[model samples]
Target chain A: MMAVTVITIVLQRNLFSVVVLAGIYSFLMATVLLALDAVDVAMTEASVGAGISTVLLLGALHLCGGEEAKPLHRPWLPLGVALVIVGALVYGTFALPEFSDPLAPFRTHVIPRYLEQALAETGVPNVVTAVLASYRGYDTLGEVVVVFTAGIGVIALLRRVPRREEER
Target chain B: MKRQMVLRVVGKLFIPYMLLFALYVQFHGDFGPGGGFQAGVIAAAAIILYALIFGLPAARRLAPDPIVEAMVALGVLLFAGVGVAGIVLGGNYLDYFVLDGDPVAGQHRGIFWVEAGVGITVTGVMLKIFYMFAGRGRSLDER
Candidate 1:
């Protein structure tokens, strides 16, 4: 389902359809995450990727128009580079431990400690929340700042036009 | 403007539930499959749905640009403040253990505030982006 969406998005010339397809792709990815039992990530992907991003893209389409422009030059170099990168990543994945292996390095490491201690340490029943908001507080704080910066950037780029007219 | 009666009625009925569910996700995150990030996005999405149905100007009236902008900064400040608070309380930066006399309670308190901060910022960011894109190209008279 996900691969089909991606292929259709690539083949489609209409920017609007591409955006919609991208949303579908995100929804499929979210379903895959849910199947993997990463509910938190699935929820985020559904909301941010499928829902908000689709709206934002539509708004952008309103400004830029819905049809995609044909490329003036062929993208042979970038395509080769992308394929090589994908190949490398696929090769690297071969070295990864088998899925959900009990004796895997990850399973043997800090996760057991977190599972044992997170409830007592954070008083939060959800281990993901405890880790995100308490144990990895600094990282979450950085993420918030990044989100804030994105808002600032969008405002800076888009908000000034109306204010400039007002000044005149 | 020709407003669809069915859309108006259905949207009115649905928006409240969306907002209520967002709150549930926010407050219940500690015990569920949600957290501040998910809750904030859900809340922002509710408002965006409102904007989509009722138009951008009406949505702006409900959540003004100034307030939304303030929320973005305020959330970051709140998060940083919690971390600074840890420093002032004689623990390491962002140390939840020293937030109160009881280490466990302090951890809870710290996580709560930190999550709230994340929620606020995420909500603000999502809404701000929506406003920026929606406000462009269209004039009030056109809507």
Candidate 2:
């Protein structure tokens, strides 16, 4: 189903339908994440990917118009490059540890400390929160700064448009 | 969109719950599967829904441009302030262990503030981006 959605999106020329299909793709991805037991990730995906992005895309669509432009020519070079990159990624995955492997490097070395000591250290039952907000507080702070920076950048770029353009 | 009565009613009904759920996710994150980032996005989505149904002007009126812009900076300040507080309390930067006499309690307090900061910034940024996109190409009077 995910593949079908992607194919349809690639083939479709209507930007509006493409945006809606993209939202559906995000919903399907969120469901997959939930089934994998990554509930935190699933929630983020559902809200950010499906909900917020869908709205943002529509707003953008209003500016750019609804029809995708026709390609100038067939793109055999780009397709071959994409296929090669996909093949490389698939080959690289074979070297990764098996799913849920008990002896995975982090599972043995890093995860035990968090699982065993998180409650005592942070008094938080949710290890994810403890890890994100306490153990890795600095990293999260950096993430927030990045978000702040992006917001500033957008405001600087977009707000500069002369309001008098309406008069023209 | 202005004449779509069904959309307007359904949106009004759903928006309150979305905002409420965003708050729930923000505070309940310590014990549940959500956190500030998710909550912030959810809240922004609620506002975006209102904009879609009722028109952008009403949404802007509800969440004024200046206030929303301020939020983007304010949240980062809050998060950084928490770390500064740790230093002032004689702990290392971001050292929650010394925020209170009890290290665990300090951790709790620190996480709460940090998450709040994150939530605020995210909500602001999302809304600001939405406003920029939606308000593009509009007249000054319309904006």
Candidate whose TM-score is highest: 1
lDDT of 2 at A9: 97
TM-score (C-alpha, index-matched) for candidate 2: 0.95
For candidate 1, the docking band is: high
Q: Pick the candidate with the highest lDDT.
A: 2
Model 2: pairs clashing at backbone N, Cα or C within 3 Å? none
For residues B19-75, write the lDDT of model 2, one tens digit per residue.
999999999999998998989999999998898889888999999999999999999
Worst 10 residues of 1 chain B by lDDT: B134-143
lDDT of 1 by residue, A5-76 (tens): 888999999998999999999999999999998999999999999999999999888888898889999999
RMSD of each: 1.6, 2.0
How does each model score on lDDT?
0.90, 0.91
TM-scores for all predictions: 0.96, 0.95
Candidate 1, residues B1-143, lDDT tens digits: the string is 22978888888999999889988888888999898899999999999989988888899999998999999999899999999999999999999889899999999999889888999999999999999888766632234
Model 1 lDDT, residue A143, Cα: 93
Q: Which residue pairs clash within candidate 1? A: none
Give the per-residue lDDT digits (tens) of candidate 2, residues A43-147: 999888888888888877777789998899999999999999999999999999998999988789879999999999898888988999999999999999999
Model 1 scores a TM of: 0.96
